[model samples]
Target: MADNLNADLSCPICIDFFTEPVSLECGHSFCRDCILNASRAQGEPTGSIACPQCRQNTARLAIRSNRLLANIVEGFQRLWQPQPAGSGATPAQCQLHQQELRLFCSEDLQLICRLCWSSDAHSQHSCTAIKSAYTACKANSIQLLQKKLNEYRDTHTATGLKISETLEHTNRLQEQMAAEFAELQHFLQQRERALVQRLRAVAESAVNQLVENMALISERCVLIEQALEEIQSTQEQTQFLREIKGILQRCDLQTKPALKTPELHLGEFNGPLQYTVWKQMLNIISPAPVPLTLDSESASLDLVLSKDQTMVKGRSKLKEFSHHAKRFSNYGCVLAREGFTTGKHYWEVNVESIDEWIIGAVKESIDRHSAFALTPSNGLWTLRKWNGNIYGPHHATESECCQNMNLQKVGVCVDYEGGQVSFYNADDMTHLYTSTDRFTEKIYPFFLPFPETMTKGVLKLFHLQL
Candidate 1:
């Protein structure tokens, strides 16, 4: 009974017991200050105020104070004290009117008593039972939490897989390092043994030559001694004199410069030891070039690929190939099967005097259906040979002219992490051009054997020493 009376005494605007209560012409009442504030918020220019409960406009801002309602609210306030939580004897009540909070205002997102819901402030606002609002809001919160939980679980699983992959890669890399070191050791041992053997052979040959010279000198000495003794015994002067001339001539011939000891040719061993070894090791230890082949799926319709996929050429008749999203539709181009996202890679192409050809590295995301110049801006870091004698790096506005060198083979080296694509004359590994640009995605080897004008040139792919 107290709750019912308290509700009747409360002002709808403030959801509290009326203070200085005032009634509008519509017979519904509100605190005088509350109604004035609401009127100013409405900003009506007619000098009229709208009743908070009925929305009826009054001609003047005449708010008549209700002494009866104010007196009742004062008495209610004197008797009402906030009910404590968990006090099993009494229910929770509004602080102002001491009425039970029954409904939730959807707009204000707060609890309100029955009278507060019917008040002018909330008459136009939607209200729902507290239990219904709690159930709906809790379901939404749980749904969001569940979605995040699933996402976190998926991330955890993916991280585990990545960890496993890293371990496998690490093991493989260690094994490769061990194998390479063993091979290097073997090469060094073989070289050392060969050098020692060669040195020993040289020493033995020199000793043998000296021994032969010594034996001849000993023989000459014996002959001269015999001749001297024969002269000394001189029983017959003429025989002695005849033998002396021959002996003298023989001595001169034998003594004529004993062969100089053969000089030992140290050859390469006499030079810088580490430098010589390094020079020799280059032939055996150069990095193996990246193996690349034309991707038939990415070839233009007018291009023909060889059976091994290592060579490509242009053909007038369109090939009967399947429609692929990556196929070059508007350009006579093809990409290698392999794409690189990291590390340095090198591959060679034999253009073989192709009048219209392009060789380079292109981003994997380049447009396939639209035509664009093979330029850096277009994701193609390429060198082109056109009109049979002209060579240049392709650009959108104009090709940067390069001195024609009749380049037949081109080497493309892409350092993905370094963001550089270098072109070389494959015949001598001469640097032809290098394009330095930012790379954020996978890059593929690009090739265009022949343009639309002539369709008979071929380009070949091969691995070479870098």
Candidate 2:
């Protein structure tokens, strides 16, 4: 109610309690000074004065001091005291018109009286019963609040999902790191055990040889001592001479074999331990075991496939064999008999005898009948030796020219899950190159003997040492 009372007394111009009230022809009231200032300023520009509330024009700007209304305002001022909560005995009335505030102005969204609605200021504005307006607005407010609540809920759900993904990623990284550490630990233990075994074998072999030599010498010494005893007991000169001659012939002291100690050719353990462990990782971390053989069905016509299918030689004249659809008709390439689906695999190739060769893995369905570019994108992951230089796929020039002409064997390893394929020097376990690619289908070992103009090279599968 106090809210209603204060709003009525508020000036439309100053928006405060009206001072020395005045009324114009339009019946809208304002403070005396407020009306005069507005009228003078408005009429000075346009010869007609307009009512501030409705903008209605009039011939005159005569605003008379509302003495009767002023006196009423003064009398009512004493009654304009603040109301306390729930003092619902008497309803608050409009201080301007002394009317009950029963109507709600939809445009202003506030309570008003019948007199306020009658004025041009609110005549065109939508008005309704205060109770009806409150009911409709409350329903809309509830929906709006619920919509805001749903938005917050969606935000929380998104935040939670992000948190879960982050945690999962963190755990995966931790697992991979842990597995690598465990692999290193296991490899170190295995290496230590192998070295210890080798040391024992070397020591045992040397000791056995020395012990055998000692036994032979002991027997020879006993024979010499026996000869001396017999000679000392001999009374005849011929017997003594014959015994001495026999002893000297049996025991040739001057011609005794020289004692030689076997040198233990154990490899140096004092170099970089970390480097050694890292190199061994390549041998142990294979995705799968690949014992491969050349597929005779996929061999080129110029290739002579060995009976064991473990070797192929490039020849000038095409070999006499039954033609097959799977065989390469245009290029010197061959695929392995077996293909890998997943995991890691390792295989070695003896390329020392071959003058030129291309060795790596390839997708099983690679194009083999047409003239093709040997690149990774073309399903080939190979390293080539041409003109005594080593090159990879799609390379224009040799990345590493084969400086060591004595280079021979190379080991290839693959990891499907890790999407890695690496080549190494087989003799010294030295890294040559590594290619990284995701596998979409089964991959097979690829080999080619790039024979020189004068020499027909051979590509042979290297057998396991043990």
Candidate 3:
């Protein structure tokens, strides 16, 4: 009993009972003084402190005391303490047997009186002194708990991001459907009106043709009536006979003209159904790009800004523009005149004369003179090409150094709030690279095409919308 109690209450470092236990981020617990000494033994290069047990890094300066653990240790100590013989009433005794409950079953996690240990339920179970089981359980449980907590935190964050993106996608889909449906309805109405007008014209043409025939018949009837009056009033057989002969000759083999109906062809309602419209709508409905122009102030000295600032070239020998702090000094990088703080924007770049370039979204405050690698860690999310190699921002080996690396034009797509930028070949829209961001400020479309002296390179900004 005494040995089990000693082991349960012992601190791993001191090999004695715990004296103010503290928890480390790695799920390992130790005496408060012991863990602190271990942390100070080694320093983190990145300024984040690392746990001595698992080596997990964190920025916390000091760890909090495990108060609940301390209380449990105290309770176990009291439970194991020996009472003066006959001075206290008694130690814990099992209710059924009135015998002391001594053995602990690790699997059942319960104390068993001596009589119960020999019973059918406990005979095959592994049992040890209660104190030994308690100590072992606490040792493994604390570490397990810390691991679970860390896992939960990461899972929660990832789940939250997924939910947000999914909801946004749903909303965007709804808006697209609404717009397409409205357009389809408007189109159907115009076609229906046109068909109805054509049907009325057919009826009108048929009625007009019949009316003209009737007018001609009425004129002949008037002539016949005049001839009959002349026959009755003249009272001369020879005059009547002459008129009748002329009428008979004119009427021979002649018939009324047939009424001609207008051959009106009404437009048909072609349908594969809504799906067909939706599919066709994608090709017909082109959304306009958000209008933006370049900011010459942010242009690098080696670059020349066009009069409208929408185009820039490396070859122009324009007079040097006034200097500004925002201008890039070291790298041949230039920022767009306008910066995007939020929303989705897409634009295309004409890389006609450029053989080497680095283009993507640049942080608003990128270091101009730092020789540091232009990586995402340094606030640059770029897809770069040097000599003949095309490189992505993610991995060192994620590059193609082939001789026939065809890169004529490039497309830049930015999702500001989503913290992503994707680049593609403008001609075929073959995906080139995509980067995740850690953006905290407004970002602009950054350009770093080779200067005009380098292969007559020219980087022109043009808006290509979806």
Query: Which candidate order results from sorting by lDDT in descending order?
Result: 1, 2, 3
TM-score order of candidates, top first: 1, 3, 2
Cα error, candidate 2, residue 174 (Å):
2.8
lDDT of 2 by residue, 3-97 (tens): 57555665566444567887767888787665556667454444455778987665454666777767766666567644566876665687777
Clashing pairs in 3: 294-337, 295-337
Q: Which stretches of candidate 2 lie over 4 Å from their true place?
A: 1-9, 36-48, 58-61, 82-172, 228-236, 254-261, 268-277, 284-466
For model 3, the local distance difference test gives 0.70
Q: How far out, in Å, is residue 111 in model 2? A: 22
What TM value does model 1 have? Answer: 0.46
RMSD of each: 11.6, 15.3, 16.4
Q: TM-score per candidate, in order? A: 0.46, 0.43, 0.46
Which stretches of candidate 1 lie above 4 Å from their native place? Answer: 1-19, 25-29, 51-54, 58-62, 66-193, 211-239, 242-283, 289-345, 348-367, 370-444, 447-466
Q: What lDDT score is found at residue 381 in candidate 1?
A: 86
- Alpha carbon deviation, residue 102, candidate 2 (Å): 24
lDDT to native, each model: 0.77, 0.74, 0.70
Candidate 2 clashing pairs, residues 3+ apart or interchain: 287-343, 287-344, 288-344, 288-345
